[model samples]
Target: MNNWIIITPEGITKSPNDTFYENFQVLGFVTATTKEAALVKLKENYSYINGSGFDEVWIYQLRFSNPNITYLGIEQEEDEFEDDFEREMVHKITCILEENCYTDITYDYFEEDSYFFEAYSDAFQEVRVDVKDETIEVYDRYIAEKHFVHFGDIKL
Candidate 1:
């Protein structure tokens, strides 16, 4: 009851006006059953994640079994995971996703996390500094990172 896979969470959510918000990009899971419907769902999520927010792309692979659900980190055979494996994993089962949780192997690929840019960056990849007005901005759009500015920081 074990399907090897990966789970990478980046956080992809932004405002329509290209403003910075609680946005991220990260989801990599190994799929089981290979159902066309399931595949469609996965692909849709991937597209939406990549299409939105700064061009931050995250890909995860997931392979799991019935009861042995596992959301492996990302894939760092040598490195250890930051998540508390046994402690964080809850058996309450919130949403039964294909009856498969994750695989035994997991690693993380923080393409744009705290380590990538400023520590407080919501979307680190888009983090930028404006010398014209001495302002800090986290570009929210891949097509237009300059479209957004801190709500109150925009000097009139």
Candidate 2:
């Protein structure tokens, strides 16, 4: 299976008295055999309402194995972590050897021991994490490096 990113147009309402705002929203990530299958899977899994003012959903296949280009979003604050585990995990993930680099944790389904992250400097980078035997494997596609750290080693 391959990883894919789904994006859709969304309208946000700040408050009852505010006007509706339009923007592109990331639906989520899905794994499938192909792009068409990924779209079908996403539509079936997510209750996305299709209608006026909303553009067609855009799907992009993520090249995790040998990714050279990735999306770079705004820098996120480190204080978003709710606990020590999250804080440590984010720290370890974003410790890239690049100057002026920014990292965004796109997905952090920690309950499933899975994470999706993107980092940017001169080029975009993607990182995927998988946990096995209490050890987390960090795959940094941009640097073409793999890092393994035991969960116990992550000081809480």
Candidate 3:
């Protein structure tokens, strides 16, 4: 079965103070064996149901036909553990620093399989690690100084 989504155009809602606000939101979604069935249901609901606050609604059929993708369905199995590469990188960096006599270590935000970490041994230094690529780079100053940039070339 294919998944379908119904999106409604932006509409205005008047608050008690007569203040109006607009929003574009999803009306609902459904699963059907065919796109025609989903479109029919979407039209029926929008025409005869309590769909009042919107000017227009659109129907989208979710296509999962890409060979490189696999859907996990709606259920997660017990004993299933997802691997977190970023956490592994943090742990590796922490262990390396501890072994090398770097103390007072801490880490900030993990995103896109990368994170910035800092450690002090009478001097402050920051390092960014990309877990997916197994690359580590050092920063000359505190992480706050270069929080916006992701590229650092000094490998460790």
Candidate 4:
């Protein structure tokens, strides 16, 4: 059986045009026999927040694999370390993550040229994954402050 998880966007709203705020909450996993079954459960539980035009629900396939490392293009010294592939890979990923300042940075402008951040137990690394209808919008903290209050739970 395949496992799937639904990310419910709690306290999510648009403060202005092209700007949105939402604290994504994990709604737990759903056991199903196929991808279609998982999606069916997602659609069944979908609900819209009151007076909130946002209706998109994000779902992901749960994988048990180790987190992937994103390789950001960074210049490395040829003799930095003697054949230390893991160290080299970690350094490159760290460089890309640092350049973005670690604030929900996303890159999808070009195919095979996009990046995302994933924090593991001890370090942060970049990973490549095809985003479905992925959008990276500017978060307006000022506007979010005035319109929303987080209650530490789903407000439904």
Q: Which candidate ranks first by TM-score, i.e. highest?
A: 2
Candidate 4's TM-score reads 0.26
RMSD to the true structure for each prediction, in A, is 17.0, 10.8, 20.3, 15.8
Error of 2 at 62 (Å): 1.0
Lowest summed-lDDT stretch of 10 residues in model 1?
89-98
lDDT (tens digit, per residue) of candidate 4 on 1-156: 766765667655565367877777554355677767876765554333333454555667767423355656766555543346434443554454445444333332223422233433221223342223433221111111233222121111
Give lDDT: candidate 3, residue 72.
48
Please give the RMSD of candidate 1 to the true structure. Answer: 17.0
The Cα local distance difference test for each model comes to: 0.31, 0.57, 0.58, 0.43
* Superposition TM-score, candidate 2 onto the true structure: 0.35
Q: Residue 51 error for model 2, in Å?
A: 7.8
For candidate 1, give the lDDT of residue 40: 49
Query: Candidate 2 on 22-119: residue-level lDDT in tens?
Result: 77766656789998999878766554433334567789988763335454675767566668886676566455322224444354435467665665
**Model 3 segments more than 4 A misplaced:** 1-83, 143-156
In order of TM-score, best first, we have: 2, 3, 4, 1
Between candidates 1 and 2, the TM-score winner:
2
| 112 Cα displacement, candidate 1 (Å) | 21
Candidate number with the higher TM-score (1 or 3): 3
